[model samples]
Target: VGGAWFAGDCAALSECYSAGSQYSAAPILPDPLVLPTVQHLRESWDDYQDAVEDDPEVGEDGFIFDFAPDELHKANISGATHEIEMVQYVADPVIHGVTGRSGITLVEYLRVSISWGGMPGWSFKPDQAPAALAALRVRPDF
Candidate 1:
């Protein structure tokens, strides 16, 4: 859970300081997970086609996203940062679960999703995507 992608994306604003202790307990993992930055979401997506093509669980038409820290900005409003995951997928054997849905496997996408303008505190909907914020990368990762 500690990598360039995770740390960069997990960067938080002062508002979430109270929750700082939560991320400290991340268990050390053997796989070198990339902590991708906003700069890397697309790169990770681009790099993952082999995963999709190789895995039975993933479809060729996969959906990449503004995952992890990019999505964290939405969580910050509701103090729900705990809900997101801090990792990325690898190509071989196709890591089945890496998203924030309590380990449920969301079908991979070939591109970033248009915003859905979520309920209440979640509003990354295409129209509602927030203005650029240094702490998070809300940009679509196409």
Candidate 2:
């Protein structure tokens, strides 16, 4: 994974790294994945929200989470640099037929999640709620 240089309360870190091989000469893929399980996603979201709404020391994007090495190997493929934000919903997916288990499944699957703490502090003010709401307008026609 490439390094992430962060500023203020928001920071993006190198979750993992992978290198492509030429022909048959190749090296083991580095940091195969940045898989944050569903539980991890929930916890990270809760923590980031709490940091924004409660923790004074928590600067913008101050909360950082990464993938466990084994989880990365198991889930991450192609050595792609997956931002934690992009895979936070992996936690909502089921881990059946992979964990040596059966008949277990999870719901509410997604690919990415926005972090509350990543927002600039000024944007979270009471007076900005209306404008913020307006800016969130999503046009499905596109």
Candidate 3:
């Protein structure tokens, strides 16, 4: 149920979504959850591309050398069932092993399941989720 999506050669809306799910296993959520998740990813990708386009410093290769986490969009969705949450964030290329260039911004989407009764509750460490999730890279079409 966990995987990474890379938008390596995605350059269009359809391509972007295709790439987003290419590396991941088939989603288990119903359409209600899946549709919105896709929308969020698409919007985030668009925002990232817009930021890159607006940056005067972007190189001919379409990479922003001075990228920052805040420059990328941040969003979250709480499932209707209230048992899952999806989070999207900008991932650091160096940490994620996406590319050698520090300016290449990668986005990561994570699906976390909530548990109500346990010492740790969640399967993954909340504090360390960012680092762990950031390692998952999605290559959005630019």
Please give each candidate's TM-score.
Answer: 0.26, 0.25, 0.22
lDDT by residue (1-142, candidate 3, tens digit) is 3222221232321122323333134221111111124454456557657876788454334432222111011111221211111123334232121112233223221221112011111123344222333333233343
All candidates in order of lDDT, best leading = 1, 2, 3
- lDDT digits (tens) for residues 21-121 of candidate 1: 33233221111122335555557666666677778466534554434332333222222222122244543222233333334222222112212211112
Candidate 2 C-alpha lDDT tens digits along 1-142: 2322211111132122233122122122111112346677677668777877876667454444542322123223322222232223455434322222233232211111112121222122324333433343332321
Clashing pairs in 3: 6-139, 7-139, 10-141
Model 1 — TM-score against the truth? 0.26
Model 3 poorest 10 in a row by lDDT: 112-121
lDDT of each: 0.32, 0.31, 0.26
Clashes of each: 15, 10, 3
Candidate 3: where are CA atoms >4 Å away?
Answer: 1-36, 56-142
